[model samples]
Target: MALDKHSDTFSLQRRNQNGSTAPLTNWGFRNETDPLTDVLLGSPAHLFHRATSSLSRKHLREAPCNIQVAQAQHAELVSTYKHFNVNVHMLEPEPELTMQVYSRDSSVMTPYGAFITAMSQWWRRGENYAAIRAYEKLGIPIYDMVTAGTFEGGDFNVIEEGCVLIGCGDARTNEPGARQVAGWFEAEGWEVRLAFIDEYYVHIDLMVVPIAEKLTAVCLACTEPGIVEWLEAKGHEIIDVPFPQTMALGCNLMSLGNDKVIAPTSSTYLIDQLRARGFEVAAVETAEISKTGGGIHCMAQALRRGD
Candidate 1:
């Protein structure tokens, strides 16, 4: 359906004039009432990373010259997306670029639309605008702009049905960013809590992710007692990620509806834990992708949730 000229709320699926549902797959509608219904998260490979960086003097490290490895990882990522029956959109890299774009800011989804964030890293700053243009080109609405607050989409997490947990730290996202999102969620009558983790934690999703309704994946190493208590208060069952596995991004698994997860093949323990929970798990090797310090959850964001 066509969207209003001035509004960002547009439909990617065709609409039925006679009050019937559109034919854009059973789970493809962007439901305004259920904001999580049509949102999606993705990582751009355009920028990988450097071992260390400082605004003053930044060190640059090029991804392995082996195009084969990059292609292989992309292929794996594409298959993962297809496995979940979602669309996969890749961003082409511009020449003379530094750093890889594995963590393309954060993936922000709202009832009105999806707003991809700008990269906090100076070299990757342009990425946010690029993501915005892409969503606009695809007819996705912009819920809000994170201009004053530099936030990455990775830190945003929905712990319970209506409550969201956002992290503020590191160079990626800060207090201003958390407050920015808090304002937006508050405007919608949703509950948001700001969790202050050390900079080593990066994004909230890095340490915590919801694998299924009432089920959460967390790195026992990075999770705080208070956070655990909070999750318990919300009646969420925790699937712990062992320290080694967590470092390998084992906790970064993504949920595919009920009792199923998309995880990295390298993370044996995490996959086993998921299976123990009766989840049908799919494991793909993400060595190259994980080099940038994120796994399935970091590489992808869920835009839709099924009831």
Candidate 2:
């Protein structure tokens, strides 16, 4: 069950005239589609709002306390995103996910395109539909969906050009989902790795992220041991995400290609660590945005890359 070595993928999100989310794939256009390099990563419109959990009823009475800070953090995030040369895309807030939306977590970006996911968390299911609509508008082809397993975009990280990693735990993306991803990539002649961890590390990108070609930012404290060894085997130089900064999302760095990245304010150690490792790092204030267990890498999904 292997695909040809040279096949690619397509995305399913679409766009209206205003660059907003368009739920219809009616256009059916494929050629001349914009690449991920042309798209900019964007932040979710609301604050303290989470789009991927079953905590729908839990936030009714208890509200988020850092709304103001979250807004400021989002604005700073927007500014930071521009420095990366991204064309930001936004999703209109829907109450189905309790208004806490991590738009980037809605789907996984692949070499071919974006693959829609079946969220194991009930509150996050609607996010898939929202993302699908956006991809459809963007004219990205759809690789497929997580038919047998529950998958989330946050659990997926394209560690390298030919290697992909899938993390399963906390009911985000499960075992079946990881296997499915492996199967798909293997079919395409790509290496796939699965890291099954606790709910605390829900997404692989939360702890480990690629800053450049072979460099990664990791929090050894929570990062699984075997994966660490495997990375070393693959020739990856790991920059440990400081425990204190990791808690504040220092590990959540986003690669703007090359050796450049965007990190949050609280992770000073990460800033110094990345800088020492030869990365051009830009630090932003994200105290408000991190409350939902996501950061720079989590907020934006790279739709396409020059592979």
Candidate 3:
């Protein structure tokens, strides 16, 4: 249904309370790789390096992020999106929300509407509210808010049109949160699978992400064998990314569909593989900014993917 943008009673909950919610006509997507037309990104103007995760803490302790360079890199990422003819929307910058640059952590755009996620970290919780306001401004109704427990958008991975793979790392996304989300989708007749991962990995997107329909990128060393088997059973072609590169967010990429992808320059392995497959790859340097804890996929929220 089209949203009445001027209405004061603009519904915030677009999802059905009992399931069978109709997909939004103007916004949201059925899957990750579907010719992305609109995307949501957060501003890095106020980004700051923080001990958000084990990887981030390690980077902070070893070599602090150069904020200026990170900001510059983010600009390049935005430019890359523009080059692909994707409409980019930015969330208003808030100084206190230093890690806001990772837009995928706050909300997930689903077929029904936007799912406002509950952040795990105390400092990041405010991002949920920020995300709500941003969606309101964009005329996108919310599906629902994660209330059972803390859940981040990175854990909500849509494997296909009516299927999703949720991740529970206990740190960023807990079992309760994962179960709550899984139940919602299950009731909606979606094939939902929960992947319990180690906290060190932070989120499942780091090790497993969809590149295109029936094609996925995975780090076999870190992902559970069952998950790998599950993908294979569904006829998904897995491109294994080495453990070392996976840790550097090599598996984390945004597929623009129609054989196009936006990847991190650090992910040389994945980029090379995609290029070899005749996919147009736009490699942007994100190593400096990633020290704050996220890759290309984590930094962008797909607003509208299929037509």
The candidate that wins on lDDT is 3
Q: Which 10 consecutive positions of candidate 2 have the poorest summed lDDT?
A: 26-35
lDDT of 3 by residue, 91-157 (tens): 9999999889999999998878888999999888888889999998887888888899989999999
> Model 1 over residues 7-30: C-alpha lDDT tens digits?
444443222222222222233222
Please give, for residues 1-307, the per-residue lDDT of candidate 2 as tens digits: 7433222323332211122222222221121112225432443454445533322223323554366777677778777766677666666566555433465577766555567878776766777787777776675666667788788777877777667777888467788878876777676666788898777566787788877766778899999999999989989888887676776667886777656677887888878877877877788887665665667777777654442
Q: Provide the TM-score for each candidate, comma-separated.
A: 0.79, 0.81, 0.96
- Which stretches of model 3 miss by more than 4 angstroms? 1-9
Off by over 4 Å in 2: 1-36, 39-43, 48-64, 98-101
Residue 90 error, candidate 1, Å:
3.3
Separately for all candidates shown, the number of backbone clashes (residues 3 or more apart, or on different chains) is 16, 27, 0
What is the alpha-carbon lDDT for the whole of candidate 1?
0.61
Of candidates 3 and 2, the better by lDDT: 3
**Candidate 1, RMSD to the unseen true structure:** 6.4
Q: Give the Cα error of residue 128 in candidate 2, in Å.
A: 0.5
lDDT of each: 0.61, 0.65, 0.91
Clashes of 1: 16
